[model samples]
Target chain A: MANGTLVLIPTPLSGQPLAFSHPPEVLSRIHKITDFAVEKLQQAVHFLVKTGHPVPEYKMGFHPLDKHVTGEQLQDILAVLQQGRDVGVLSEAGCPGIADPGARLVWLCHSRNIPVEALVGPSAITLSVMYSGLNGQQFAFNGYLPVDSHRREQTLKTFEGRSANDEQTQIFIEAPFRNRELLGAMLELLQPETRLCVCWNLMADDQWVVTREVQDWASASLPENFENKPAMFLFLATPRQKAVSGKKSARSKSTGRGSRTTGTKKGLHRKRYNPD
Target chain B: MANGTLVLIPTPLSGQPLAFSHPPEVLSRIHKITDFAVEKLQQAVHFLVKTGHPVPEYKMGFHPLDKHVTGEQLQDILAVLQQGRDVGVLSEAGCPGIADPGARLVWLCHSRNIPVEALVGPSAITLSVMYSGLNGQQFAFNGYLPVDSHRREQTLKTFEGRSANDEQTQIFIEAPFRNRELLGAMLELLQPETRLCVCWNLMADDQWVVTREVQDWASASLPENFENKPAMFLFLATPRQKAVSGKKSARSKSTGRGSRTTGTKKGLHRKRYNPD
Candidate 1:
């Protein structure tokens, strides 16, 4: 018998209606899967119940998928797949395998040649990038900043330099309570012209995403209820003027570069040219 | 009157069923927005028609959103928004403001403090990372590489070196026709231990995502229908052991580092540890 597919399922970002965070088709398609590896069992059960999954919460197999998830536990889930029963991988919030522990399970399935499918859904990282109106063409998600004060300051300066040099957007997240501190430190340490974006309560009724230069942000006041809320922080430094380099400058985009229109008869059209 | 909201809408990846690429809720929510800034007019018309938008495609407003889109065109769109009518931004494929020209419009909105909403949807870049089973926590999307062969070769080596030193998953895209050529160059250029992943025809009937070491890929045969398909290529060089440097190694994670469980009272839990 063929091994069953491993489906990566994304959960809601908040307690908002399912329609706001997921497409109905994804919910319907994954409803039949009786096996799941989830970040937190209670959260997954609540999500399933909210989505009206036909199976009773007690009937489905729920395996812990946190850092402590053991190899033997993964083997057990793999055994279920080998027995021709599909298993779903669900993260606490957002798409599985991106900034979550679910990647370990997906990696395991790939090593064994078991097919893996990642469904379309919301990601805070992706949404924050979009809402920030920053450089999405070239960006990096650095997960979390160093907790230490001195190190975090140095890291911020380094990221700002890299961003200015490469024109790449730098993204990272902070725990809700510590967000204010991070912002405060950013205002104090980052360059005056650096742009900073704070995205809070994504997909919620009162979702907020704002961007401004560090100088502007220094004078602005954050929302009253900004603390204790899920947030994503992003920054971009003003791109520096091209320095005179001896070797062929790799940063030059004088050559045409644009999106490749796939499955179109027009083939390739160089529509955009962004200068350094 | 308050300025209208700017909604970032993602289009389908292929000629596949709408249900396969988008959730019903997103289509429904966006159906009533008659004003749009799209990469191409015909493509947006087809997507709206297929999704069963009630209005006639000809009747709805369509503005070109390519590089050629002028300041006057954007001013017209902004005027409509200032008139309190929501306008949608649609890319050729995937999410708007991401690896596309929609970002320029988005930046315009941000400069004016116009509201922007990013709905949940598909992004080939995000999906490829999830399916690659690579490091999604710390990854960078470098858009496209230099097209010149010599520069392209040097860029590939630079990306590989960065990946090894930073433990980052390096991602880039190529025109469908040139994907095979890119893979050929990667095989000859990347180190033996570096892992490479090719994700082609995402969300299609025969979607293929496979990751193998450079040595392994050197001996494998690609699928026959791999050419002329939308694809994302990713590679990760084996992370070199931490070098003993005079200054403190910046990459050290001796302290805790993990996801910040949002909206929950549990605060922070440092679960996983990935050593250098």
Candidate 2:
């Protein structure tokens, strides 16, 4: 028997009752769904209550990372589909499958020939890109880098090589605890001038999206409350050169010296050569 | 005086009737909008008629691209904002400021510190990425590569470098007429097995999104009737090189010279390795 449709639901941001981008109408439709897979049943219940939706009395299947998703779990979800029930999947917060665990389910669904429909909604990745003013043409998302220095360095090198060739933007994330360490590594490895866009607490009232050179970031003091906050780091290669070194000189010129002084004697001379 | 809010209106695909994403309720809310800067005035008039909204009889200003957008034009738009009137900027299709000419107006609004809000709607880039199944975390959106071979090669080289280091996906569009030429160049420059996702006439009934290896694409005949058609090309670097290569080799060994004779031997060897 053909399994039911699997609807991937994106949860709301922290402290915000509304799911990231989904409107009230879409949320209402999702609430009425009878069969579903949720990352956490308790959180799902809380969300429904806060949003003022009647939580359906369903023994929702759980997809916990520590508990390996067994064949029985898969069978139960499939049975819901076989019984003509539309199964919905919800993430804790933000869009599913982007640096989230929903990817495994999405891939499995695709492999099993099940149809997957992704409704448009709020994604920190998209919103960050929009506000960053970085080149949106080509980009790579490397997810979260390894915490170990050696492994992280190897990963960063791979990202650097790719950015050097194509001038494409590279997006990666780090655990809040290791944010300063990762940022420090990036500043040392990447060109001093490489445009880095950091999106912290996106879409929320306290959101901060800033694009700055690596050297500037290195010099500035780290945020006090960055310990447990979710953050996204986006790096755009210098327009002229794909190599990291090329970006260093460009960065110094563009932000460091360029913005400090007016068009005085030396400024006139600099303007003639570098009219940035 | 504080400039008025810039209402960024996303026009429909091909300026056709019923192509807009915004409904009547949304349009009605912004009815007091006076100043207008559109790609084409006639298309704007057509949109108003198709939507059946009350048209403002005021002599609205039109800022066409052919004519330089001077300070006067900027002032005229700002004057409406000063008088508490909202200024609307519309594009030909899809989202404004995304591979569209309306970016200049958006930049102007940003520079003047005017509030700019982008509503959720159909964006060719976002829609293409959603369907491609490629990495959506990091991406670059280079509008259109130069038609000149030298410049095109330079751009491709840049894309290659980025893909290598960051494993970022690179997206670029080509003039409808030169798509075949661009594809040819991509085949020659990119690795034989590099993946390319071609999205043509996206969201329309005749839309097509195909992911294929560069070498395979080269061997196939060029697509017909692509002239003047809107298209987006996405290139993603394959991660886990050894695994992919191993699979390719195994497939070749089975399908090529040894298939008939070695089939039984391979089956026995596989059975011995996995007793289950």
Find the candidate with the highest DockQ and give its number: 1
DockQ of each: 0.41, 0.09
> Per-residue alpha-carbon lDDT of model 2 for A164-216, expressed as tens digits?
45555677665566566777788877777676767666646666555666766
Off by over 4 Å in 2: A1-11, A14-20, A23-33, A40-85, A102-113, A145-167, A178-194, A212-228, A241-276, B1-119, B137-229, B235-238, B241-276
Q: For model 1, name the residue pairs that clash.
A: none
Please give, as one word, the docking class of candidate 1: acceptable
| Fnat of each candidate | 0.35, 0.06
Off by over 4 Å in 1: A242-276, B243-259, B263-276
Worst 10 residues of 2 chain B by lDDT: B262-271
Give one digit per residue, the lDDT tens place, for model 2 in B94-207: 554454434334445544556555443445665555545454444556545544566667667766665544445567665555556667788788876566767776545555
Q: In lDDT terms, which candidate is top? A: 1
